[model samples]
Target: MKTFNYHSAKDVKEASKLASSSSAFLAGGMTTIPSMKLGLATYKNIIDIKGIKKLSGIKVSGKAVTIGATTKHAEVANSKEIKKAIPSLAALAEGIGDPQVRNRGTIGGSIANNDPAADYPSACIALNAVIHTNSRKIDAEKFFKGMFETVLKSGEIIEAIEFQVPQKSNYQKFPNPASRYAIVGVYVAKHKNGINVAVTGAKSCVYNDKDLAKTLSSNFSAASINNVRVSSSGMNSDIHASAEYRANMVKVFAKKAVEAC
Candidate 1:
């Protein structure tokens, strides 16, 4: 790992100021640290946000659940309020990276990383989540741009994520054998807003399938996915699975999500 200067920000203001420079914000460091360690990334400064007390915890209301940016996956998985309001969401959190990662990784880190195969983005997109940034709130649809990319600007920081509790929601994934990252993961959600089908791992970024959404909106059942065709356009092709194979996995997992729900 390359040596870099580390700075711990006392508050959001300091963090934002530090972020304006060519530095990386240290959340749980689950993604950044590994990349830095592998020489895949280099940064002159590391602004640790661990000192910011406000960016942690879970808040639940009658309408939605708001998770603080620094909230760990373990916290989400064990949150009673989240479990009651959105069990499927809690289940998804529990299924993220394993125990150590769950304990150490922050929601902000996961979202900022925006990994193509990450589980959180799938839920965020499907559940109609609103990403609260230091400057403004962004709809999930507008948050992600591409692989490891987001709409976040320089000096911007993710504050929290608010999810509209779905009437019915579930997630299913086909994981890689060694890394446990998803080969193809699907998140399906149904609510008054209608149905949302967000897919990750099969593409360069988490994406919503309007066609599948229409099908599931018409009928919220596993049978609904049987007739819907998944496309390979812009889908990923790799050693784990081909574009065609991954396309098929979406349908299979969509059915499984229904069953799991």
Candidate 2:
């Protein structure tokens, strides 16, 4: 890895100021550190935001949950509040990578990376979560652009995320054994207005299916999607899985998610 200057920002404002096109904001450093080590990513400077206390905690109100950007996955998985309020989300966190990765991975870091195979994006979409950044709040639909991409501007750091609680929600993923990254993941949420379904790892970015959502909103059954077909047009076709396979997994996981819900 190339040597780089590191700055320990005292707060979000300081971290934002320290960040630039050539600099990266370090939260848990789960993805960034590995990318740096592999020489896949390089930076002239590293702005450490892990020290900012404002970016580490969970807050739950009547129908909303706000999670600080730097809050670790382990915290989410073990939090009694999360387990009670949104057990499926806790389960999702628990299933991410393993103990060590969960201990070190932060939600903000994961969302910011926007990896195609990452799990959080599906939850974000299904829950209609709002991504809070240093500048403004962005809806999940607008946050993710493509693989490893987001709408965040240079120097803008994610502050926290706000999720609107649902009546029922569940997440299911078919993980690649080696990396534990989702080969196909599905998140289903039944809210007051309607149901929402988000898929990840099957495509270039997390995608919401209105048809599935509408069908499930009414029936709320695994059999509801039995006749539904996930198109293979936009799915990823790699050695691990084919586009047709991912298309099928989307239906399979969605059914499992509905069953879990």
Best by TM-score: 2
Stretches of candidate 2 above 4 Å error?
none
Candidate 1 lDDT tens digits, 14-101 = 9999874568999999999999999998999999997798998899998899999999999999999999999989988888877899
TM-score of each model, in listed order: 0.98, 0.98
Q: Model 1 compared with the native: what TM-score?
A: 0.98
Q: What lDDT, from 0 to 1, does candidate 2 have?
A: 0.93
| 111-159: candidate 2 lDDT, tens digit per residue | 9999999999998999999999989999999999998999999989999
lDDT, model 1, position 169? 90
RMSD of each: 1.0, 0.8
